[model samples]
Target: MSAIASSTRVLVIGGGPAGATASTLLARNGFDVTLIEKEIFPRYHIGETLLVSVQPIINLLGAREKADAMQFQKKAGVLWQWGGEEWTFDWTKLNCDFTSSFHVKRERFDEMLLRHAQSQGVKVHEGVSISEIHFKGDRPVSADWHEEGSGEAGRIEFDYLIDTSGRAGIMANKYLKSRRFLKAFQNVAVWAYWKGGKRPETGFEGPLTLVSVPDGWIWYIPIEEDVHSVGLVCHSEAFKESKTKESVEELYQRNLAASPLIADLLKPADKVSAMYVERDYSYSSDRLAGPGYFLSGDAGCFIDPLLSSGVHLAMHSGTMAAACLASVMRGEVSEERATRFYHKCYRAHFVRWAVMVSTFYDVNNKKETAFWRAQTLSKEDLQGAEWTDLKPAFSTLMSGLIDMRDAQDSDLLSQTKSRLDTVLQQIRDNHPAPNDRFYRNGEEKFDWGRRPENAIDGLYCTYEPKLGLVDTGPTERAFAAVESSPAAE
Candidate 1:
């Protein structure tokens, strides 16, 4: 890589984690970056839990200290009560450097990242919405904007665009029209906050507890020692059918009452917030990037939240987009190669997660139920194939061991296999019948990285000195020191 031109203009939409992460990294690399958000800072949002994979990206963004200072509840792993079995997926048992994550209040967490982006010299505008994206041929060249309640509006011209506008899917929905909802994951989520919920006595401390019900599932997250966030997920059709009989509040309560574990945990708790309902269905775009634009975060794809992958994917995509754009602007790689890398790597990660989540649903004890059967993978679903085809990738993703650098064919498989073998050996040396899903899944060899479909134009993500795409073999250093500018300061 070479020094990026200080005159390179990059426009980022949405000030959520994805936008913030991309803006900060692009600014750090000396690009003239501007970010616009439709909402004000500290706005209320959902998806509070995070995965350990986020730690590396946070470090790359230089926001580790700020995140740790928030004192969010530390999550070591997850506890699951599914398939008539109870097990804990402990991160400490995995062969990874970082062994923990956090459960955060999205308002505070998102605000911190956005403010950090501004501090890094990214010109940020709050309450500014992008009304329309202007395109010359197939490339987006500018955007029409307006400030909420301020009567201020203008158009921003940029050499590149990063759409992190979340579920709004400004590019995928309004412009490209490529968003497709996954029918198998059509779900509705109802959640609310509680005060003084009883903490579980078992599993890892500050763990996320997921309990399966006859129809759906419940998530118990410890946002604070006393403040907890509880949510229920049910099939969209089931929710629609029940809504005719009762309000969302009544339906949520009914489900809670039916689940003895969650009901018992909240027995002494009081509802501290209004009920919130969201269509939790999963969706993806047919394409993630084009001529001069890239779609990041929910703008690209959103998978089931069963694994708490929302923030991780957002930050991951943001980092990938920044690296791709920087690589192109610095003349280190062609625009086509960079964009293709971004699309393939980001989409593969999303599909891997989608497959993993759908498979988990199929294996649940309630697979016979209509709610579960609809989502379950059947032999006739896709040429009589089984979900275990990608079990190795699923296990790696579930353990939070995958990263951007591992996006393409490289040393990822060898590394994952060595680590997984060690973990499996320890399991066999100790417990003869290890019931932990992590251990069970670890026994399989990691071959996803070896698959030919993962590589893009024979390029892969690398970060020897800084993040950028690199050729397969026998080449000069692809990335070098990036020149500093006012933005880098």
Candidate 2:
């Protein structure tokens, strides 16, 4: 075994956000960290929109300034169109500094992360591929990988193994074999970048919008230099249905034409990149960590990118993993305790986001097409998820509550319970339900008034499964109690 006598040697596989963020935090905290990436930086990636929840992570990593330096557009919140009404989820309503985040260019954003991790003393390598991992009883002991083209190979022993290889899941998939895909979020996305689109004129200049179309929804994001990130998420069956008739590009065009609102918006724009399509993308692993191994970021779970939860979760998990492992190394907590805490923290967020995203797929566009039905969940699905007795509408979830790292922050828990109660009451009272963020399109100006309430509760939010609502309030209090306890045991 290559285990050291003094310090913990951590090998983080994958150089994306998760691996980069984890390795960076670990290295900063004095752990010997090595990060390997098969692909070099300045790479292309999707999931361009970001949520406010990621601000803390970005600030923690000291990347907020770097991001600001890059001049990516500042995203205030999300504006979405469902059925025929358009509304916005303003982050400012949360009354926090992170009310604003960025819509980044993935190539630049990723390279910055890896470089920052390197600056923090992580031995980061690019163009390297992992060949094998030797483990003993779920605990990885060593790993082997080779550099690109040189054929030069190296083996490193580790006290811990972290897989942040994104959807590839690297060690989590090949060695552990514990991946599980949620049927509700099985989706396919086809997207491309556009130049010269009808850019937002003023207050809404940099926000992201989700427009519901016939068989899928379109993501219209504003990027730098008059460029826009436009993509469509089609129901898996709808995608296949289109695929059987024409080429992917042709299918996309057919849908694009059908999307007159988006088409009119993009009329003056030019395609800057070829259309790219990815299918069957959302999934999660059985458990985050066991023994001496851990899963971070996309390796742990990837929710549907509808609310731009991808980067936020990756950053949160990576940072949380670092904090948990740091506690173990510092003797503040036992390894078993750390593992349990990590599992609880990681799984709770993933499962919570999974359940929340599933609710969105129950698209209330009044259309029963394959894209809508296949992407949606019925009352049975909601009952199966058991959202809660209060059924809090699960709206603010996309606003970033589930990603908090301190599992036991009493103030956070209290705030969460209070917010859930308030939201639940709003749903029941039907008191305008805070449509202050709604912006009607096809109009001469932005509509600052409250829009009509479009609650998806009976259909997907509060299905009465065999058991009544799970009553997440108690569970929330339980976590709060554990956190506030002196021993936290």
Candidate 3:
């Protein structure tokens, strides 16, 4: 054991949003935190868009003024083009009016966050790799560390460990194994940044634009000035057919030609970053944490990015993990209790988002083509309570409550619930339920109209899966009960 100490204040791996945010928060609280990152700052990252909900967290970190000074892209809200409709919602209408949603240049944004954390007294180590985690049970007291370019090995022991490693890392992969492959979101995304890309006219500027075609959708996000983040997220099958021996750049051009909307945008743009494609990119986790180890951000889970839930969920988890770790440090709760509480919080928010995303795969909405049809109808088996209650309402509202193409009005709330309720009833009416993992108490409620008490519950719905369903009177009551409860036992 290299430099084995009796206890460590907190050891955080990965310097992305979750790791950076957690370290910043904990350091601000006067804790000894060491944050390790393999990649150097100003590195390129794909997810550059943020939701309006992040305003509060940004405000908490006091980054609002600085971000504004940097001239970040301001957004009114998300304009989603899906299910044959183009709908827009001003998230400012959802109480995040102080700041606009952002289209960030990740190179700048991530560097800013890391620098901000350092300014707040966080101990940040860059260009270091944590080779392996060595723990006695769930309390990871030591981690083997090494310099990226050298053969030297070292170790540091800590009392608490936070795995914010983003995407299947440490606590999430080895301990919690929380990553779950939700069949509904079976797609691949090829993303690259382009300089001198199309910029919309003033007042028409938006951070996120969803251009939906038959098989899948393409996300067009403009970041910084003249540099836009473009990615094509398509069903796996659609992607394979277009695969060729050509370079990613060539494939990018060919793929863009598949959709006129994307083609028009790329006509004048030049690729600024290498094109990378990630398959089976959608996943959830088995749990968020246990004992001395906790998972945060993408380390815990990542729902489909269709709604741009990526950054928001990661930020939410980072905040939640920091609080849980603090509780353990203060002796206010046992490590086991803290883990359970964190897990509950993690699931509450994500479950709702997952269900909502799955609805896009529902082919029954009358799209033209077998590919779109199979993608949508394939989601029929997704009729669990989380799918029924929360998805319909979320999708209905997120999709503008009605397709912008025509005036055929439908009560999005009632229609969604009726369809969801029918599915729930059918599952309940069946002889043998598929599995309890996919099911939750139908009695619970969720108030999407308002943010929930804790970031985890408010974001994932991992604890009371029912909390992801329905936003209104019942959800309000349900949220109160869960919030009032003493941290999970």
Candidate 4:
């Protein structure tokens, strides 16, 4: 391992995808990383669908082959039936190299990532909980921990902390007290697993099927050839009103009955799991990073599941947090700069999704329904907001492009427009004779040669010599290669 100061130790809370990704990358970069989880392996989890972007992070961890070996259902894109409109988002239609993701059993998938972190030299302790975090003024210095069963207690001191504590955010909720729930997305989700649901006949083999109902929407995800995960999302008020009259199972069944598409798909299927309900799942923290800690994954923020972006945000934020800390430890960037970059970049990603999701809710044809109207973003909601107009942001997000520009830029909107123009020019330059059918029918394939861009604040992520941020200047790009075993043994 490279000679990182022996005193510098990193603690990662929660062994889920975010914690595992951050811990694995930091350990591979020669940092002393210890990860603690409140639960053991193969625990049940939701948000099983993934985006194409996750494949690159998996490659950076050198776990592509291992992920492939899991044999999760490959997800090509999503099929949407909104109100009376029918459309699809096929990944292959985009100008990107990676064109597919997966529909995983999250229990198995999360365990694989956690085990991968251990193999990469991350000290992991499962069935352990962080009871308290000891801080020196504004910076966290140590934490009090207790094992689940035996009740053994101990204190662990660390130089830096990465909080991937999913939803049970120790720092954000306990210390920082900065989490803020979005009223527009105050919704409830009830889901169950089924066997033998019919696959979509119109889209790719494993596309996520989304159908909008009068009150909310439904998601049909294929987990295995015969097993599927089905869920319903509705406004919280509607859910509460319905609960006053019927059981949760009855409410779910009534909503499912309202969707003709879902009813037909599950006509011959058997419900195989008990109903699971999650309330008000959309939230964001006023802060994502602080004096000596960074909040990653659900610890920092969580958006609605409309786009299946939960895992994508978790893994992406975890990687970004690890890179920020790695750069700080290597003396490649100041702690302040790294913290600012992480907070801005991660929050921008979250906000973009939030805006897009709210806009998507507005597009549902059931505007006449109280449930749908309550979820829609009104003009007053967008007044003076960072993203006032949702059209360009929606297009940019749908294109799957990463914008690393500083969120505080005075001309951010103009810069974003220019960036989108540049992307289109690159696409045209690469494909001089682009297929018209690709635009009209979403059937053609092309490459976008999408590469990471330097943030306006002079930092960008690189994966060649190591996985971390480096100065945009040429002098600091020559990163030293630390000797270590491949992330996947």
lDDT against the true structure, per candidate, is: 0.74, 0.66, 0.62, 0.74
TM-score of 3: 0.76
- Over the stretch 399-440, how does candidate 1's per-residue lDDT look in tens digits? 444322222133433433454445444434543442234334
> Distance (Å) between predicted and true CA of 62, model 1?
0.4
Q: What's the lDDT for residue 13 in model 4?
A: 89
Q: Candidate 4 lDDT, tens digit per residue, 281-339? A: 67888889988899999999998898778888888888889888998998888899889
Clashing pairs in 4: 95-448
TM-score of each: 0.83, 0.78, 0.76, 0.83
What is candidate 3's CA lDDT for residue 34? 86
- Model 2, residue 223: distance off in Å is 1.9
For residue 220, model 2's alpha carbon misses the true position, in angstroms, by 1.0
Off by over 4 Å in 1: 1-8, 365-367, 377-455, 473-489
Model with the higher lDDT, candidate 3 or 4 = 4
Q: Which ten residues in a row have the lowest lDDT in candidate 4?
A: 480-489
* lDDT for model 1: 0.74
Native-to-model Cα distance after best TM-score fit, residue 433 in candidate 4, in Å: 35
